[model samples]
Target: MDFYLTALLQGLCFAGIAFGIYISMKIFNIPDITTDGSYTLGGVVSGAMLTHNLSGYLILPAVLLAGALAGALTGIIHTKLKINALLAGILVMTALYSVNLTILGRSNLPLLNMPNLFTLITFTTNINQNSLIILTGFVLVFTLLIGYLLKTDFGIAMRATGNSEPMIRALGVNTDRMKITGLALANALTALSGYLIVQLQGFADISMGIGIVIVGLGSVIIAETIINWLRITSVWWSLVLVMAGAVIFQFVLAFTLNIGIDANLLKLVTAVFVLLIVGLPRLTGRQA
Candidate 1:
């Protein structure tokens, strides 16, 4: 029970990344691999600031800005330089490794002694419960905000740019600018996930973002599966399901570990699990 509770908390912490992936992949139809770098960049920025006793208010914006800038750089490469979107993301992600290491000035930074968002306020004496409360609130606010954004005029244009770039462009929409803005928004949320997770886990490492994009991808895939099955059309419900998908993904991992899978093999297990999530539906659909 305790183990699963921790996983649940982790899922909440991951809501940001899930939302980010939904925006990038589902809305813009881009597999922005910059997620891997931006996530760690968020942790690096937050961890660096917290160690210096910075407030969460300051750290949060800094994390978002850093991630957005990284994403925007990728967008510029793809749109302005006419580079392939995937390759542009790969370039930025690769560059961020050295950039993150330079910023941290070390491979790992311990943040246990730092004043984190969870420690700033006390909802109850139980630390885990307090963390759960804060994380839930954080996820709720972002879900509502993103949901609202997706329903707005600009947001519709962004989605239109994704659904039919030529059509949107013909309608006087600046497709290039929309792609840039959308990617920036996606990576900003990804960074927010990093910021929250570092504070939760009590440390930050240069390698923390390695393969992290898969977690978000998996969550989005799970949400996509359900959305298709239910034919969910409401933006708010779709976002809610994405958040739930994040939690469900975590639970599945927790169950796998509980069944005594070796920690070393967890990544392999994760890959296989995601494959099942993605493939099973198609297999069933074919038979049906």
Candidate 2:
């Protein structure tokens, strides 16, 4: 039970990334590869701040701003410079590797014996319960805030830009700005996940975020599948479902690990699982 509970907490930590993936991929229709690098950037930034005895609350704004800056850089390169969106994300992601290392001044940073957010915000004496409560709160607040944003006029315009750029431009909406803002918002959420998880796991590694977008994408894909099956249309519910999807993905992975799957094989499992999730719908549509 404790193992599964830890997995649930892990899922909650990942809800931010899921939100990011939803904004960039599902909403903006862009493959933002910056997720991998920006995630580590968040961790490194958080880790560095933690070392300085800075309050966890104080460090978050900086982490978020850093992530937003990374995302906006990609957006600028893609929109202003006319580079492919995919390539722009790749470039920023690649550049962030060295930046993260430089910030940490090393390859890894340990938060052992350091005052971190999870402990600072806890309401209970039990470590597990504290983690669960804090992570749950973070995920809930973030999901609601993002869901509300998506339903607003500006957010609707961003969605429209993705759905039909030419149509939105004809309506006098600046599609480029929409894309840039959307990407910035997405990466900010991604950074929040890193900020939270570094404290949760007690260490931040330079390579921790390698291919993390897959985890976020898997959660989004899973939520999308369930939403389509249930025909759910409420924006809030869709966001909630995405959070549920994150939990489910983590639960499944935990089950796999518990069943004796080698840790190194987990990546392969993730790939195959995401592929199946992506492919099954196509197969069903073809049959229909």
Off by over 4 Å in 2: 282-288
Candidate 1: Cα lDDT at 202: 97
Candidate 2 lDDT for residue 77: 98
Candidate 1, residue 208: how far the Cα is off, in Å: 0.3
> How does each model score on TM-score?
0.96, 0.96
**lDDT for each residue of candidate 1 in 1-288, tens digit (9 for 90 to 100):** 889999999999888899999998999999899999999999999999998888878999999999999999999999999999999999999999999999888999998988889998999999999999999999999998998998999999999999999999999999999999999999999999999999999999999999988889999988888888788899999999999999999999999899999989988888888888778878888321
CA lDDT of each prediction against the hidden true structure: 0.92, 0.91
The candidate maximizing TM-score is 1
TM-score of 2: 0.96
lDDT of 2 by residue, 1-288 (tens): 989999999899999899999999988999999999999998999999999998766899999999999999999999999999999999999999999999999988999789988777759999989999888877888887888888999989999999899999999999999999999999999998899889989998999999899889899999998888778889899999999888889998998899999999987887788788768877888321
Best by lDDT: 1
Model 1 poorest ten-residue lDDT run: 279-288
